[model samples]
Target: MSERPYVLLSCAASIDGYIDDNTDERLLLSNDEDFDRVDEVRASCDAIMVGANTIRRDNPRLLVRAQQRREDRVNRGLPETPIKVTFTSRGDLDPQAQFFAAGDIEKIVFCASSAVDKCRDRLSGVATVVDAGNPVDLTAVLAELAARGSDD
Candidate 1:
């Protein structure tokens, strides 16, 4: 197989090619049918990732909504929910966000070396914080995820 985990980027955009309208309220880009499709995709993956901006903006739980899907993962010897990941430069994240509080699965945070101490202090009980060099290296993050058995 490959040295790194297979990465899949999933998102929805409007017909006008806009992701959001810069509103305080969250936008609904996908309908119920498409949301079910996304749930299926989440069930198949070992992990799911978003940036700090996404967490700050959307505050998503990133959990498997279908009970059966969560059960299927447990039957397959995996966590009920996929591992959640996020990367940040300044490490400005709320400890009480849904991303940290809503799931029983592992949460990994990649941050710049300079921000490691502060990030760890803030997210100490909430996530596993890793320093990814001065600028937060994506390559290192991927390798670390692969090592943790995240094949997706």
Candidate 2:
């Protein structure tokens, strides 16, 4: 079999298994070193994924922040970073969220088949939304990206 194209879930977390601890409380637990390491991992990954909770809670820019790596992508003619992704089983992604306004960064959202009308209407090309059966399927998300020239 061929080596499967990998999609990475790279997230920062606190000791309590959250992308951030005291999530609603908005306490910071990560340092610059941790963020740099995350940038390094993102430089190598084909695509990155996050959950609805993570997106809504963070309102993150979601771009790799390493200047050196951004230059490398320019040298190689690759994208500034890998695809940024979000998952919402209902397809009810937040269009007004900061993530949607990140220019030059490609985003993909995965929704349950039944949620197509519910979510897609609000989002135009802000992100590509796919119906991956009910309850949402991560595997289908990866496959869709791969087919669209996003795989390694």
Candidate 3:
């Protein structure tokens, strides 16, 4: 088995290589068929992660949407929803966002070392804040997640 969680970065981009059309309204980049596929993937993973910008922009719940999928996870001794993770440089995440408020699963925030204290203070009741070095170390973040038993 691998020491770190298997990471999959999924996204939809426009033909022009942009994720959005630069509008205030959220764009629908993926179709319903793709959404179902994404739900399946979410159900299979031990945790789901996004950046701070994604949390602020999309405000996703990141939960397993299908009841059967959630049940399967529970039957397999996993939470109904996977753990949620986010990385930030400024720790400017909103505690009221669905990323924090929508699920009973664990929420982890990897922030820059300089912002750790501030993030912990602000997100005390919402998420567990971890320092990710001066600029938010991706390696350390993955290692920590591995330590927490997130294998995928």
Q: What lDDT tens digits, residue by residue, belong to model 1 across residues 61-121?
A: 9999999999999999999989999999999999999999998889999999999999999
Q: How well does candidate 3 score on lDDT at residue 118?
A: 88
List runs of model 2 lying over 4 Å from the truth. Answer: 1-3, 11-23
lDDT of 2 by residue, 26-56 (tens): 5566798887888888776656777787677
Alpha carbon lDDT of each predicted model = 0.93, 0.73, 0.92
Q: For candidate 3, give the lDDT of residue 78.
A: 95
- Runs of candidate 3 exceeding 4 Å displacement: none
Error of model 1, residue 54, in angstroms: 1.3
Write candidate 3's Cα lDDT for 31-80 as tens digits. Answer: 89999999999999998999899899989999999999999999999999
lDDT, residue 9, model 1? 88
Q: Could you tell which candidate, 1 or 3, scores higher by TM-score?
A: 1
In terms of lDDT, the poorest run of 10 residues in model 2 is 1-10
